[model samples]
Target chain A: MEQPHGPQQQRPPSSPPVPPAAGGPAAAAADAPHAAPRAPRRLSRRRLLKLGGLVAAAGGLGLYRCGLYDERLLPPGLRVLGRREAAIAAAVIETVLPPEPPPSPERVRTLLAAIDAYLLGLPAEQVEQLRWLLLGVEHGTFWFGARLERFTRLGARGRTDVLTGWQRSRLGLARAGLRGLVALVFLAHYRDAPAFAAIGYGGPLAPGFAGPPASAARYARLLAPPEREPGW
Target chain B: MIYTAEHVRRDRVLQADLCVIGSGAGGAPVAWEAARHGLRVVVLEAGSYLEPRHFTQIEYDMVQRLYHDGAARTTADRAIHVLQGKGVGGSTLHNLNLCKRLPEEIAAQWFADHGLAPLQGGTLPALFAELEQLLGVSELGPAQANANNRVLERGCRALGWRGGWLRHNRRGCVGAGFCELGCPFDAKQNALKVFIAEAVEAGALVLADTWAERLEHDRRRVRAVEAAVRDPRTGAVRHRVRIEARAVCAAASATGTPALLLRSAVPDPYRLVGSRLFLHPGTAVAGIFAEPIHGWRGIPQSYECTEWLDLGPQSTRRVWIVPSFAHPAGAAATLGAFGAEHARLMRDYAHMAALSPMVHDLVPGRVRPRGRFGVAIEYRLDPSDAAQLRLGLVAAARLLFAAGARRVLVPASPALELAREDEIEPVLGALSLRPHTLDLTSVHPMSGCWMGDDPARACCEATGRYHHLDNLWVADTSLFPGSLGVPPQLTTYALGLHVGRCLLAALG
Candidate 1:
């Protein structure tokens, strides 16, 4: 089955072209032996209309089955992964990014739901590729998960350890994928959630972090450090 | 019972010793100064104050939340895309934090030509010293620099093009390389953290989501300012506030300040109020390398080329090449077209390091009032400026190739690509630098409302006070009499500080 290109699809060369009836007025005057005869004049207009309708219906059905109506038209399932893989992936992300104080389990669940929705919306071919990518993550996490689960479900400290290890090994590809997925999840949650407000993180939030404070007292504090106490 | 002010419904009057409008680079500092001087300063910001914690690590949301019109605002001719910040910190909140002082030569030119004698040698040095100390401008170390920047440095060194570390107003910057998205780490120093926060703490009353409409003048003096306050979240009309001050400063930036004055009909017979606009047009060159550059993992811009600044006429627009990385959507939009080929490019995201060279030209644009309070700008790039753009593009392409770019994309119509070193010049030479064929944008916009000795040629006087109006003053980039040839932030701050002192003396 051929995939549909944007708006300009070409027909196969084998298809016959529709021509005017041969052996009619002009055809008869320049007639050669190969000129075909005209169709019978007795055919009704209703019959012609019925035939056209049938052709249109057939074409529409063909286009629909070829994924013209659906964005994701998968080729073949490479593997049948278990829900446990997805769950384990979520557990790892949570471990890597421990929720801050006002922690809401709802936020995590919402984020997961959003990621699933985004994945479902992707093209079938892309979805297949992404699933493969996720499998790579699953493989890497399998051994790590067992050891992590054995020790307090991997807090921020443990997550940092895993991240640092990955960085030192120069696993940039895996890190990019993980970062992309995490960013997407975080964005979806922020946009969908009503309780949160967008923050100005990039450009100019504050003056130079190391510059003298606007206030004299604050400036002085920046220069001084907390005093060390005697050991008890 | 529902009440109505003289002009608009749902009105309330607020009083303060000084009322500052717009809370970005300019107003933020002015408010801080006034409040610190024991004056009751009220800052009216058109955008909301967003906290750092609320900033997401995503590109799309970051742009939508931080950028003006989600980074879609442009000139009427669409020759240049202008990205401004709308939230509390303003454009400072979304800037790359490239802080550099205005060149001395440019300062001297303004002083001699425009009669801005105050900005002469000795005075200029003192002002710059104060500005630098206040802003904490410094250079990024090798550890803070990213691999992407190193590629530019390597290319410049190989080709013998001068380059050095770009100074930035930052401290404790971990180099996340997300400066364009608003620094989540609070490392990039913007006015909000330094000036605005300090001002608020110093007893300045900042009213977010309030837009000043028109000035209420009594003959030759501005008696008060009328504004419409709205809830930023819902866009619902909250109330109308009237602020009365002995001095009124319009620090609403290049675009906003001009629109305000034009709406108030502040008499400019010269018709130069919103004219002589200069935008440092820039374009980027992306290089794909074999090794993982991880461009997004380091500083967004840590290096630049100063050698190009003194390049003689006919030399292409010179600029310091800096490293940059965008969010996925932005990356995709810039990368152009989506498919398996695009996906392969994404796979090598770690290998891509980008450099943008910005050019300065004397070609001026004008801003006209649209309706009553809005503004519509018209810009036309001169032939010489166009040539400079082409020159910059060619030079950037060569540098990328020298740095071993497997593939380079030039952001122009009929986008040219170079795979080999030999094909670089031919591809760049074949390109047209016409205004319509190229994609140009500006982060720094100055000289829309100029200050000069002659009111006939300038919008305001040397003191930044409007020609006819006694107490009305302009304290933003709009007061820049001409192009500073470098970043305008330091000059703007210095001039603003000078204007404040002048206002104080006059009032006394």
Candidate 2:
């Protein structure tokens, strides 16, 4: 039911430019709608990854040297992350998590599986975007750091340095990208049952205890009889 | 009747007197009001209908079910995490149920500057009272304050600062402490339990798992809505749907309303659809206490510190501080650090309570449609707003120290851990407020499709109707002309009711 694809697919209109509020709190100047932010570029992560692939190809390196399908630990049924993407994600997870009490191989595999499930649940476009993010991290050493080696090839110290650089990068895009990946790692790592147990969280309070139920009669008065059909 | 995508086996065309494109605090109230007025209402909810029994209180599963993008949505810059609701009740499903009315000062500004005359002359107060009664809004007493909330109260008393208990819309909350992940006991008097159910009772048809993709409209009036009914689990489109209606209300969130507007390419000559976006962006400050604070066991946020909050246009301080704690998963994400330091913070999860200082920001951001059914949010804090947030952070640290925190954790790159009260100012004051430098999150994103008298300054009329279209209206926080320096749920409900009345009048 989309409108004819032409001008409609173009970038949405940007805010009219305004000078910064002079000598006043933004709370007041917000009415002036001051200091319109720079218009954002409508670049897809997929397109960015393609450009990165092209850059690597132009650097006298073959596609294989750019770390494609290198990590074959793509567990069964994960349709989103490819083998190399999974390897890069695993490396990023290892670098980003706490070093002490190192995660076991089993634990890492579990985390990867959790991440796969989470990614699988997202919209297809977002899954593609996240795949590109993993790929970008794997191949971004030449751009983020001066090193030409892939992220997975780097040792612990080198990988740490590269990730730290991305985290603190002046380019907002780089920081944003790294932050997104790290957030995924943390979300997967900390949302599990063992993590909850480690942090003394009791998980959900239902089944065992429903927590004093709210007034049933009060809500009962508000509901009308169900119609004959539940679907229209 | 409520229908999910599973019930729709084929592409269908339906007709209704009103087609509302969301079912949150905005859309549900309008549907209820309209259905009660004998209008054939059809509500399209892009998410499934989850009952209280369906709420498991599990953080990860609930977030996946209730939140947009599985709770991973961020601004285009990826600096700020934008947490919005996706289910039938929208954010009311997960919100802490804090009920605060729009400040009169901001309303006066809208009236005087934006020509929103209906806001004044005792119109809004009456409407607010009606909504408060419907939702059973009540002020929490000291008895309701948990150990986490007591941190704020004790801090206020120790520092001689201004703070008090907040009002909420829960009737019989047992303090299960998972408000951000849907309520399990159905204690929250939210849109799902109240308005949407009542609307259905009044004969409105709610189509769950139905995504409104476009508004079919001519130059003057919206004639129909085009939608896709998708599988809730896989998001695979099952059937195409079109609902021809006399009126359409986009009660989608602030981000969603504008994205829908731009996606439909409705006649917007002034280019005002998604230009002025405001997120009351906030960051949490965690305090390490000697004793256990079991911060996740009781009512999440009952106390608030308002010493630093001023709603005036030229006010220096505009931070609304409240006790904010998350589950173990959320806490780990909020706490910064990658190595042993991160482990050390997690060990003290049982002894930590946190406070979030939300800025009453004025910096306008932008929202545009990205890929189909995706929202591209472009927002960055201006220097003034950033300064205000920095001050709020400092204030939060001071309050934590005053309440006898052994150490305070400021979520920044290489996170600041101050052990002494004197170290708070010297350490936090020099911190830079940049995109990725600080961890900022927003629960409130508003004012994208704002209302005003002038066409140049507003997308909708003060009556919440689109100025360029006759039968189109917006009923959400997107109608806010400026930042509401307070929780926007009560106001959103009131506006939905107001718009519903206006649309009914127009229909007549």
What lDDT does candidate 1 reach at residue B69?
A: 42
Model 2 interface DockQ: 0.20
Q: What does candidate 1's lDDT look like per residue over B82-173, in tens digits?
A: 76776677778788777777676666667677897655658757866876777788877666777888888888888998888888888777
Instruction: Write model 2 residue lDDT over B1-508, tens digit each, in one string.
Output: 7777767878889989999989999998899899998999999998887767667676656777898888888888778999999787889999999999988888887888788776668879999999999999999988998999999999999999999889999977888898888777788999977888878778888888888998888878988999999888777788999999999999999999999999999999989999989999999999999999999989999999999999987988999999999887687777655545567788888999999999999888999987668798999999999989989999999999899899999887656799998887778788878787888999999999999989888999878899899999999999999899999999999999999998888998
Global lDDT scores for all candidate models = 0.62, 0.83
Q: What tier of docking accuracy does candidate 2 attain?
A: incorrect
The top-ranked prediction according to TM-score is 2
Off by over 4 Å in 1: A1-232, B1-10, B233-237, B311-320, B371-373
Q: What TM-score, over all chains together, does every model reach?
A: 0.68, 0.87
